[model samples]
Target: MEIELKPINIIFIAFCNNPKCKNTISIDVEEDTPKDDEITITCEECGNSIRISYEVDTI
Candidate 1:
């Protein structure tokens, strides 16, 4: 038996805490992802880790 794969779309914006390297990051996640989830991302330029949280409003 074979399983079918479906594509999911997610939008996330992560900002670096480093003052010298204030970079914005975007990430794609799976379906039904938590809106009020905290995601930790590492900065490539500054090599610092930052946490970001956001909410998704469903209509």
Candidate 2:
């Protein structure tokens, strides 16, 4: 038996960890981007930044 699978798009929302800043960042991953890619974003309201990593696995 054989199985077929497809890649999926992922959306990530990151919030500023700073107590004084109240901002949220949205990141979108499409078919053009790799499944296991890393992203870095900075807060608009403040100077805070964060790094996000994605890893896909099958079971």
Off by over 4 Å in 2: 1-3
Provide the lowest-lDDT 10-residue window in model 2: 28-37
What would the per-residue lDDT of candidate 1 be over residues 1-59, giving only the tens digit for each residue? 98776544776778877888878877676577766677777778788887767665654
Q: Which candidate should be chosen as best, given TM-score against the real structure?
A: 2
Q: Which pairs clash in the backbone of model 2?
A: none
Instruction: Give the alpha carbon lDDT tens digit for every residue of 38-59 in model 2.
Output: 8888888897888998887766
Candidate 1: regions farther than 4 A off: 1-8
Q: What are the root-mean-square deviations of the candidates from the true structure over C-alphas?
A: 6.0, 1.9
lDDT assessment of candidate 1: 0.73
